[model samples]
Target: MPLTRRSLMDAAAARFGWRRAYGDTTTVDELLTEQSEAAYTEAADHAALATAKNTDALAVQPGVLDTRGRILADVLSLEGVLAGARSRSLPSEVVKRLEDVVDHGHEVTVLLAAAAVRAAAAHTSSGN
Candidate 1:
């Protein structure tokens, strides 16, 4: 079965003990949202930098570099998560959830990286 966002959140909640609160008061959406806050912020930053109009190399380079570094770090962190999940013998469903999250992150990062490259190219060609 194809995994839905709810399933992913459920799996994460199960795997991470997010549902362990007294009376199970914490909702899956809240847990997922809390966990995703940093990632969402970084993604938003990447989108803004990618879509920015000003092509000054000096101005844009720092944002591009920062995005690149974050992407690399995310990749490494995902790898570690997968490795740890395997070592811990996590259920296949949970593993799939992790993979799905990583896949989406990769897609966003790739698009953002492409846009940053194009922006950088435009800056270079414009002699900015």
Candidate 2:
């Protein structure tokens, strides 16, 4: 599979602790372009989620360094995407995807943390 919007979204979901699966199929170029904003939103959501998880690291919380590192990496990845798109002169639509990711980062992170907690509960129960 080359890469589809679904695959991209799946990758983002998995990065944020989603246990779901994705199918194999590359999306057509036009569809992929159309879904660029969705893809970026997903990535931004995951990045913010990671950030929220690590936000309390300075409060004498143990085991936060690792998560904080993960958040840092996610932010870096977002920056890389923006830079790459700009340098390559990618379509305006592609660049437009990052707008929400940059703007609502903190809110997304908080939401992500809540989602992670829920997923953790479900995972634990399912394993039992």
Candidate 3:
């Protein structure tokens, strides 16, 4: 079986945006994958939704996309220039270590923030 661009758009619209007009939307992991084809598939789905409805209603707005793109560019630039170096200014292995650290930092920051807020809320509710 084969699909035209039109059918792809229709299917994406069903998977994304306002299908039930106020229900659970797909997670980022669900929308993207390591497979390049799946990446295109998700883009097609997202494109379909944009074409089919108001783009402003998107749960994950496009500004976040710009921010993430900048972060990715910074990461790649550092990796290309500084990763695995034998120099003193910035060793290549140091860059690799930083990459691993940054990767975990994202999750760690989230957990730290959540814990901070949780503790604050508990203290406030308990009234000392």
Candidate 4:
């Protein structure tokens, strides 16, 4: 049978072990919409925290490198998940959510790099 959105969502739910509470009457679209909102919010929160931490680290020393490393790892992990979702023919909405998460991760990396540069310049001028 051709893959309808419902079929793909059902398959994804099974494969990813996504389950609703017993007797829950939520439709798949509703569930996906909730999950998408949650994913976006969580990613934004994480990116904000990471950006703050990296900024603090830059102020203190060159430890921002370690934070950047972790950010890169997160970006890679998100990319992997996105690739898997695409490969499984998940819904465009789901894929888009994942892409947004990945984009947030990338933004954190960029912020970290800029902070590191500023920190390095400050340290150089201060002869620290």
Model 3 collision count: 3
Error of 2 at 127 (Å): 38
Q: Which tens-of-lDDT digit does each residue in 1-128 have in candidate 2?
A: 43475578778889998744324333455456657867897989877766777543232233333454566567667878778888888998878786446545545555556555655565566673
Mind giving the per-residue lDDT tens digits that candidate 3 earns over 12-116?
888876232223344333333324666787989877776766333232334344445566566565555444452445665666787676675455545544555
- TM-score winner between candidates 3 and 4: 4
Q: Rank the candidates by TM-score, best first.
A: 1, 4, 2, 3
Best candidate per lDDT, number?
Answer: 4
The collision pairs in model 1 are none
Please give the range of 10 consecutive residues that has the lowest summed lDDT in model 1.
19-28
lDDT of 1 by residue, 11-123 (tens): 78999776434235456556567659868989898777667754465466566667777987897789788889988999999788888878887887787677788877877
Alpha-carbon local distance difference test for all models: 0.73, 0.61, 0.53, 0.77
Error of 1 at 34 (Å): 5.5
Candidate 1 regions with alpha-carbon error over 4 angstroms: 1-28, 31-58
Clashes of 2: 1
Candidate 4 residue-wise lDDT, 100-126, digit = tens = 999999999999888888877876777
What's the C-alpha lDDT at position 118 in model 2?
A: 59
Question: Lowest summed lDDT over 10 consecutive residues: which window, candidate 3?
Answer: 18-27
Clashing residue pairs in candidate 2 (N, C-alpha, C atoms within 3 angstroms)? 48-109
Query: How do all the candidates rank in terms of lDDT, highest first?
Result: 4, 1, 2, 3
TM-score of each: 0.53, 0.33, 0.27, 0.53
C-alpha lDDT of residue 71 in model 2? 64
26, model 3: CA deviation in Å?
46
